[model samples]
Target chain A: MSAPAQERPHLLRIGDLARATGKSSRAIHLYEELGLLQPATRSSGGFRLYEPGAVERMRWIDLLHGLGFSLQEMRGVLENWWSSEQGPAAMEELRVLFQRKLEETRESIRRHRDLERELMEGLAYLETCRACATPAAPVKGCVHCTQDHGMKEEPALVAGIMTSPEPGHRSGRGSFVRVEDIG
Target chain B: MSAPAQERPHLLRIGDLARATGKSSRAIHLYEELGLLQPATRSSGGFRLYEPGAVERMRWIDLLHGLGFSLQEMRGVLENWWSSEQGPAAMEELRVLFQRKLEETRESIRRHRDLERELMEGLAYLETCRACATPAAPVKGCVHCTQDHGMKEEPALVAGIMTSPEPGHRSGRGSFVRVEDIG
Candidate 1:
């Protein structure tokens, strides 16, 4: 009974846009409220309709979010660029921001990589304990373990758990290696 | 004059413990409140004192925190292990927990690595745009760039920025490749 979509200017309803973009309606509304998104027009029934370009706009927002920009910060980025008179100057500011973010990302990766190595070493050590023969071994005995763990030193992760209270300086026995010492 | 540290049972005051552990006094208090930590005793003036082993315990807490356990969850882990009858069973639970965390850490590393690549590719593409000759060129013209950027295809990070609203299918010009399409 109505006109074809092609003849009527192909606009997407809000639900359709949300489905296509994999964003919740509430999230789309928040983006609209934050000035990150705009509707192309309102329908005869007062429903919001979006242009096809809005899908690409959503992708832009997501990319910025993944790069650790808050919505408020993203608005600031847009406002600063649009308000500036020179395009090259605005772009240079963006370049500096991107460079700083890149450094932060690299640092994060480095820290996580260290953590990954620690975890792998910890797992390898734990695998040896799976067939632990001494069920009757006192829990405290793990601190001074004599059974060869087949490694030069205990991993920091396991050492942290087995660290026992040190004896006084007068005592002759050697102290258990603390986690910090291993590091 | 106050007695020497060695003569006074060698306990650490809260301030000394915080300094040694690199945690705030408030964070230590929270750990104590959550049953994840405990003070060995109180001074005559009501100040908290900790045993030397607390330093190693703090390291354990940091290791678990780095592995993504919430303070409450850590409390649960301790309770479960301490309450169990068998040593091997408790160690087995810990082994499983460590294995799961290793997988999660690897996955996180993969995602961050991807982000790092995207950032590098984006920075590379933007380098080509830094020396644009057409300061007078319309801002929208970037979406359909005629300049040869030396890359076979645009990176998703840059493509997301340069995407423009499409003309009708009848207009016959080739469409800009979207970020998701490249992905």
Candidate 2:
């Protein structure tokens, strides 16, 4: 009942393309201005039209942005590819670029994982405070807590919140003293 | 002989604190301007001085920045803590904040971990291209590779580079065709 796949006229007007890609028309125009995108043709009413493939291209651009490539850098990447004298050279350059990004991504994961653990431990330490016997104690009292939550030392994330270095003490290590020791 | 621990004058001038914390003096001043930091006192010469604990505070601020807290939000956090009528109320508010941040951090880790895998798989796919038989082949030939490097399908990251959707095809799924099918 429907037209065959090869017989379909699949051009999308700019608005349709923007909606398909979940990007604003302004963003699509910016991509066009940057030479990162192009219209496949124009409609009879003078509206720009794009191939459905433009959606995939827009998504590819977004993925590269997520991977930390600036628009200018992405433009440079395309230029580098097209201008390369041979396929192997372009492929080698891309391989190196991807390799560096992978290393950076791994390092970012490491840092976030470390913070994840810190937040978990800090939350566990705070759980004991919910049933505090001295809920009325001054907030500053937390630095030198005497209520005996039974932890040997405060988690650094929580300790950072509750303590300041004692005035007139030169020791860099002084700030990390146990909450009980401070008390 | 070294001065007795109790008798030491441990105040650090702004420049010394900046060097110790690896922050510029301007950054320390900006933190002060934002009311997120303060001087412990002023030296006789009118230079700002800080307690050694200020270093720990600066590090804490950096950690918070890493966790995506802006300076204004950090100021609000301090205000919330001090304005609380009781310690338990303050701790409860902080507990909620940390719980949300922990969730966000976990999400960030998941996204980055996904990207890490994509890059690794993309790199592995590229490895086969290193010894490409037709190093002199037009770069576009990669989209419908005929050399039989033995990949069943292109990784999305790599396919994204090689192909554009064929014009006049309405299928959203048309862009992801295998290399052999496209050829």
**Strongest candidate by DockQ:** 2
User: Could you tell me the C-alpha RMSD of candidate 1 in Å?
Assistant: 10.1
Report every candidate's CA lDDT. 0.68, 0.71
lDDT of prediction 2: 0.71
DockQ of candidate 1 against the true complex: 0.20
Each model's RMSD to truth, in Å? 10.1, 9.2
Interface RMSD of each: 10.1, 9.3
- What TM-scores do the predictions have? 0.77, 0.80
Q: Residue by residue across A119-176, what tens digits does model 1's lDDT show?
A: 8888888788767777666455556667767899888777656453322222122333
Note the residue pairs that clash in candidate 1.
none
TM (B chain), model 1: 0.77
Please provide, for model 2 over A86-179, each residue's C-alpha lDDT reduced to its tens digit, 9 standing for 90 to 100. 7776788888999999999999999999998888887888899988988888676667677666678777666656555322222232233332
Per-prediction DockQ comes to: 0.20, 0.27
